[model samples]
Target: MSGENETVTYRVEDHVAVITLNRPEQRNALNFDAYDRLERAFRQAVRDPDARCVIVTGADPAFCSGDDVREIMAGPKPAIPPPPTVRHAPTPAAMAALECDKPVIAAVNGAAVGWGMELALYADIRIASEKAKFAELFIKRGLTCDVGGFYRLPAIVGPAKAAELLFTGDVIDADEALRIGLVREVAPHAELMDRARALAARIACNPPLALRYMKEGLRRAAYGDPRELGGWAIETIRTLMKTEDHREGVASFLEKRAPVFTGR
Candidate 1:
C-alpha cells in the first residue's frame, strides 16, 4: 500500500512501513504542514498491523535539512497566546515517532542537521548513506533542539560527544557519525534504502509482540522520561526565540553571513 501528500509519503512492503519526507527541491526542509503530515504518517504506520517495522528516509540529495528557515523563522514575530497549563506535551511529530511500537530505522541519505538530526535520533536505529551528514545545529540558530537530542543523543553517542555536537553545532560526516556510534552502518549512497530495508526485514521476521516489548524495554531502561525533558526543552526554546541573538542568527543565515551573537 502506498499514499502520498504534498510533503510526506507512506508505503508498506514486506511488513515494513516506509515514510519519506517528500520535498527534494527544498532538501526536505519542513514547514508546519510537513510536520503534521509526518506525524500522521507515523500514526498510520503504528495502526497498520502488518507493519512490524518502520523506515524513515528523505528524498534524494538530502535526508532532511531541518525546518524551512525561510518559512518558519524569517518572518516578524507574531504575538501569541500563552501555552495551556499542560506541562509535558511533546511536539506531535516527535511524540508520534517516539511512541511508535514498531521498530523504527532512520535511513539517512544525506544531510540530517538540526531538527533533522533530532528526527534520526528518534529512530530506534539509524543507517546512513556515504553521503549523509549529521549535526545538532540548534545552537547556531540560538535555539535548542527538541527532546530527541537531549534524551537520545547522549545515550547513543556519549555525554561528552553529545555536548560537543550540541554546543558547537558542528557538522559530522557519515564516517565520523559511524565512528561515534551515531549510525549502525553506512552504505553506498545508491544502496542506502536497500540496506535499510534488508535490516528492517530481518527485524520484522521476529515476533511482533516481542519486538514491541523489547523496544519499549530498551527505551525505559536507557533513557530518562521524555515528557519532562520535552517540557523543559520547549520552554527554553521559547525563551531563546525572543532573544536578540536568535533574531540575529536567523537574519545572518538568511543573508549568508556570519552571525554576530550578543548576550542580550
Candidate 2:
C-alpha cells in the first residue's frame, strides 16, 4: 500500500509501514498542516492491520528541522489565553506517535533539532545515519521542550546528560549520539533506510499482539504518565510563547543575529 499527502508520504511493505516527512525543501520543517498530516499518517498506520511495525524518516539532506519557524513563529500570533479546551496534549503528531501501538523506529538521516529531536524521541528505537545531527533547541528558543524531551530523553540517556543537552542546545553528531546511547546503530548515510527497514522486518516478524503489549508494558513500567507531563509542557510553552524573550529568540534567528534576552 502507498499513499501521500502534501507534506507526508505513507507506504507499507512487508507488514512494515514507512512514513516519511516529505517537505525536504524546508528540511521537512512542519507547519500546522504538516503536523495534522503527520498525525493522521500515524493513526492510519495504527489502523492498518498489515502494518506490524512503523519506520518514520524524512527526505534526504535532512530529517526534520523542527517547526517551520517562519510560519509558526513569524506569523501573527494567536491570543495568549487560547479558547477553552476540553483536553491538553502534546502536538497531535507527537501524541499520535507516543500512543502508537506498533513499534516505531526513527531513521535519522540528517538534522533532528528542536521538535525534530522530540519526534525521534517518540520512537521506540532509533537508527541514525553518519550524517545525522541532533539537538534539543527549545532552550535557545526561550521555551521548554515537548513531552518527549522531558519524558523520554532522561530515560534514554540518563538525567545528567539530558540536562546538559537541553540546557546548552548544542548540536551533537551521530557518533556522539551513539556514544551517549541515544541511538542503537549508526549506518552509512546511503544505507540508512535499508538499515532501518531491516530492523523493522525483524520486529514485524514477532507476534503483533505481543509486540503491542510489550510496548505498552515497557511504557507503563518505565515512563510515568505522559498526559500529566504533556499538560505541564503545553501550559509552560503557552506562557513562554507570550514572553518577550521568545519573541526575541525568533527574531534573532530570523535576522541571523545573537538574541539579546532581557529575562522578561
lDDT of each: 0.89, 0.90
For model 2, the superposed segments whose C-alpha errors exceed 4 Å read: 1-5, 77-86
lDDT of 2 by residue, 54-168 (tens): 9999988889999899988777755123325524666667778999999999999999999999999999999999999999999988999989999999999999999999999
Candidate 1: regions farther than 4 A off: 1-5, 76-86
Query: In lDDT terms, which candidate is top?
Result: 2
Residue 33 lDDT in candidate 1: 77
Per-residue lDDT tens digits for candidate 1, residues 42-86, read: 999989998999999998899999988988787553311234665
| Candidate 1 displacement at residue 200 in angstroms | 0.5
Predicted structure 2: lDDT? 0.90
Per-residue lDDT of 66 in model 1: 94
| Alpha carbon lDDT at 206, candidate 1 | 98
